[model samples]
Target: MTTAATSTTAAAAVPFRFFDVHVVRTRLLGRSMVRITFGGAGLTDFASGGRDQRFKLFLPHPGQDAPVVPTEAGEDWFPQWRALDPATRGIMRSYTVRAQRRTDGGAEVDVDFALHGADATGHTSSGPAARWAARAGAGDRAVLLGPVEPDNAGVDFRPPAGTDWVLLTGDETALPAVAGILEALPDGTDARVWIEVPHPEDIQQLDTGAQAEITWLVRDGADGPRTGLIPDAVRAARLPDGTGYAWIAGEAGTVRALRRHLVGDRGFDRKAITFTGYWRKGATEEQLVEEALSGTGPADD
Candidate 1:
């Protein structure tokens, strides 16, 4: 029962530790996303669980040199963080590991952030994380609560044995996870994927060995409206012939709707589908974290 799928579903805390990482470089991955490469001597021990690996990122306050995380508290860091002054405490957010590399210089991890700034209509909707990432530079410091083991609880994209094919759905928020999953898939595996982005330029070349049919849906397309683009696209398609496992993540509402469609209309086995609402519309990360800590909201959707 100690399979990769079971590892994430288990309630046991993941084997994670805190690391003081710094931005080594940044690259504009697309119009609405940026990839920040983090490196440090501490990263030598920072293991990435690969596909869809989730981790907590702590960014510094405006005037701080590095994020103020009580890493010395060890397993009790969360409670310590809660007790700190919110004004000076590090801003916390969750992100997926796009890739991990061990170059001659040192070990590095790439995290892709989705920029949600206002469109051409002159509005301000970007969150603290997005704003910070937009201006992040080389040598910027942050704290990371990342895995120390390769088979930790953070990696969630696990399809059971004998899975004939797989279905993946994600919006811009889940793009990093989806890309990681696609790259980790076994060669010749059948994968049906749908990705929604803010603009056509947001799409990128993804490397995968699986027989994946990836459809990119742009929200700003002049041809049509954007509501339910992924769901509608999947519904209209002819799925591969076999039992399927689905891993979905994106906007909360859309994720739920697509899950219902798959279970009710497509008749997929409920247990075979792993869904995560990476974020919700109009909800701040602080609010979600508060709810999660107080046990008042849904856990990992």
Candidate 2:
């Protein structure tokens, strides 16, 4: 029972590590998104295979050279950080590492930011990190922390040998993670993915090594409100028979709902599913972390 579709083993690969870096380049990738690339000496030690790893981005004050946060020089950085006034600590946003490359004497990481508009995290207004991403350019420097260590970073995603079925669900925030999963699946993996996005145009085309039956659920325009669409889609999905894992992520409510539906309503093994609430509807990045630490979020919606 170690097929590419049913295995529960953690990735045998070494876990990607954290590093500090500086912004080397930044630009607009879409009407409402920006792509920033970072590089520096510390990046040289950054571990590989960080495709879906989350990172903490630290931005310096508008014209400051170095950030005010304690460096690795401190033994209890996070505790010290927790004691600082939120407003004075600057802002930190959670983002996925879209891609990475190492060459010469440095490494580079690319991150995509959804520009603030009618819909966005909203903390982008005066937050140092947000403002930096909004207008960052070459020659700018900032601290890049993470490759957030997942509690189970090395988990191998292959299915058990006898299984032939699967279910996948997530939103734009989780797309990169889902995409990473999809890319790792073997050919002919019998899986169906339900993806939710703000607009039809937000749908990204991906290339996967596995055979996947994918469905896109658009939010807002013409597709009705996103609401409970992710779980609804999964509820109505016709997955192949046999054991499989259910992967879900995104906004807190949506992820909770899908997790409940899969394991609670459908009777799947709770341990067989991977669910993550990447962010919240109205919570800022700071609030999201506080909530996570407090272990408070709506019951798996």
RMSD of each: 4.3, 5.8
Summarize candidate 1's per-residue lDDT along 1-301 as a digit string, tens digits.
0011111352245579998889999998778898999998878898887889888899987789998899999788989998999888898888999998887767899999987762334334676677778888899999999988888878788887779999999988899999999999999999999999988889989999999999999898544223689988988999988899999888767777888888998988878888877766656766666766676665333
Give the TM-score of each candidate: 0.91, 0.78
* Position 41, candidate 1: lDDT: 82
- Angstrom error of the Cα, residue 17, model 2: value is 6.4
The clash count of every prediction, one per candidate, is: 0, 18
The best candidate by TM-score is: 1
What lDDT tens digits, residue by residue, belong to model 2 across residues 1-301? 0000112345533434335566777765434456788887667665535435555566666556756566653457667766777656635556666777786867787776654332234344433444567766677766765533343343434344566676777776567667777776777777888887766667777778677888988775543223787777888877677888776667766777677777777888876776666666655655566665465644443
- Alpha-carbon lDDT of model 1: 0.82
